[model samples]
Target chain A: MKEIMAIVRMKKTGATKKALVATGVAGFTAVKVIGRGKLVTDTDELEKCREKLLALGLDEVSDAGDTETLVTSFLDGSRFFPRRLFTILAHDEDVPRIIEAITTANRTDYGIGDGTIFVLPVADAVRVRTGEAGEAAIW
Target chain B: MLLIRAIVRPEKKDEVLAGLSEAGFNAATMVDVVGRGKQKGIKIGGMVYDEIPKILILVVIPDGEKEKVVKVILSTARSRNEGAFGDGKIFVSPVEEAYTISKNALGL
Candidate 1:
């Protein structure tokens, strides 16, 4: 069995979760992160991004100010790009297809509009609530 | 099932997401990533670029979804005006089996 993880970018927040669920992914975990990409070119683009984020109340500079409200709630931040981790347990043969799906979901020719895919061997997995074990049995 | 992984140009993330969403596959995960490919990150003068921000997108999909997903990704990543360079690559592998421990949902 295997486990797959992806770092995807969505136009808006929550798209990743929705897309993954639609693909019939059994279960996955997501984590919020911060990253910078090559997309930001000049002051115009940066200003536009900052303005858009501020209007959405996603821009946070102060510790307990406008952004603290969404730190955990909305996964919102002023980061160039929000980093999120998606992980799933699967069988070995399913790796390639999963990577393809993610690539399709995040590709761009211009700046940093792309996604990366990663896979790892699953030693063991268990559903804490149900006590399920093994890669196949506990995805 | 096959696991398809891609490290793409960061700007095209939305296109990738939309492509997957339109293809009836919407669920996925993302993480802030830093790495370089082919160009070995980026080049300037004689110095090597150390840190480049990228995203790692991963998915576990049925075999049938691989081709379609790849096509979508390649198309989305390719620039209409220009092409090649930082379009990135996609990696594929197999999944032995799948199941949800709590519900015992197997190989869906």
Candidate 2:
């Protein structure tokens, strides 16, 4: 079995879901995650993220209302971008098809944070209800 | 530490939790998710229900205790003596890195 984790733009999630369902991938898990790639180019968006993060008490900032410090941090370092993570487990033979479906759904005219897909080998799977394991557990 | 992900029936969540706690494994993340095994949900009459709700329990534990932890989940997550379909699944994977946010520490 293969576990595929696709981090995608929130705007494209609906289409991605439709495409995956159409490909006969029955079930998946979607998680909202905040992450960043290499840099933050948009100052406006960076300010907003800083504000939200500080408001949520995730920053080790001396002052909560320091917009200056926030701006400085945004300009100098990393920034968080909103992303949706989709986790799908499928048979090895069907992985390529599933990736194709995801790619087609999330394709963009110009790609930046279009998202990323990480595929990993699964040691085993068990169907809790039926006591099925291995390939039989993934359907 | 290895990350053990167990997808099990929602109804059996408490048992799994109790069993794990009893086994001295404390930390875990639980998420409510929808999926189905080979049965592909339940088909009643002409209705095809393709997705079934399940709980996914994620536990990052010491690698050496993988088998013991899996045993705890299995015994608690299993439906019957012989087990049945849709009982749930457990997936084990390697954890390359880990951190504790409060302590600002990393696993070496």
Candidate 3:
């Protein structure tokens, strides 16, 4: 089985969800992730965003997984940056088209921001929701 | 077979996967990666940030499903705010072969 992972901006979550659901591989695991990238915001606006998100109870932990991306001109210089994690387990055969869909979804909707994606082999898989193991669970 | 590499805003990962899975390309692999585009990373004050968090999803597909997956990623990742920035990027390449190491088998 393969595990497809993606990280995107918080604002794009809704569209991302629609894209995934459309593909039959809907099961996924997600997390709120923080990042420090090249945002195009001025000092004042940056501080304002930092203050607002902090007030909203968003605490960004240091990224230990190296899962963050940086784009200088995203948003034509908008400096606010927030990210999310999306992971799925699937069979090896299903990878290519799913990736294509994901790219299409991300590109058309990203608007002003840029991000990155990579795929790695899944050594194993188990359904956390139902405890089903191996390929059966992933599929 | 073809390999599709989509560097999208990390948030779009789930929706994109859900769409591809539903389309019959049910399996894919993912990795956590960091990189920047011509935009050249974000600049705050004197410091320039070059690295961003991105999820890399790797999937091998028979020729048939390529278009479907591409379409799904495109439509979903688009935004109503056309003036904003940081939407993400995608790349596709051909695969000469595929195999499941554990199964010790060739071809999907």
Q: How well is candidate 2 docked (DockQ)?
A: 0.03
Better of 1 and 3 by DockQ: 1
C-alpha lDDT score of every prediction, in listed order? 0.60, 0.72, 0.60
What is candidate 3's lDDT per residue for B1-108, written digit by digit as tens?
777877767787777666666666545555677887788998989998889787766666677877888887777665553623566776777654453322223455
lDDT at position A126, candidate 1: 72
TM-score attained by model 3: 0.42
Residue-level lDDT tens digits of model 1 in A41-135: 36664455445545764444455475645443332222345666577776666666665555545554332334445555767777788887876
DockQ for all candidate structures vs. native: 0.04, 0.03, 0.02
- Total clashes in model 1, counting residue pairs 3 or more apart in sequence or in different chains: 63
Q: Model 2 Cα displacement at B77 (Å)?
A: 0.6
By descending DockQ, how would the candidates be arranged?
A: 1, 2, 3
lDDT of 2: 0.72
In order, the candidates keep a fraction of the true contacts of 0.04, 0.00, 0.00
Which stretches in model 3 have alpha-carbon errors above 4 Å? Answer: A1-139, B81-84
Q: Please write out the lDDT profile of model 2 over residues A26-127, one tens digit for every residue.
A: 699998765433344677766665566556663455554575566566444333456787899888889878877777778674344566565667788898
- Going through the candidates in order, what is the number of backbone clashes in each? 63, 18, 71
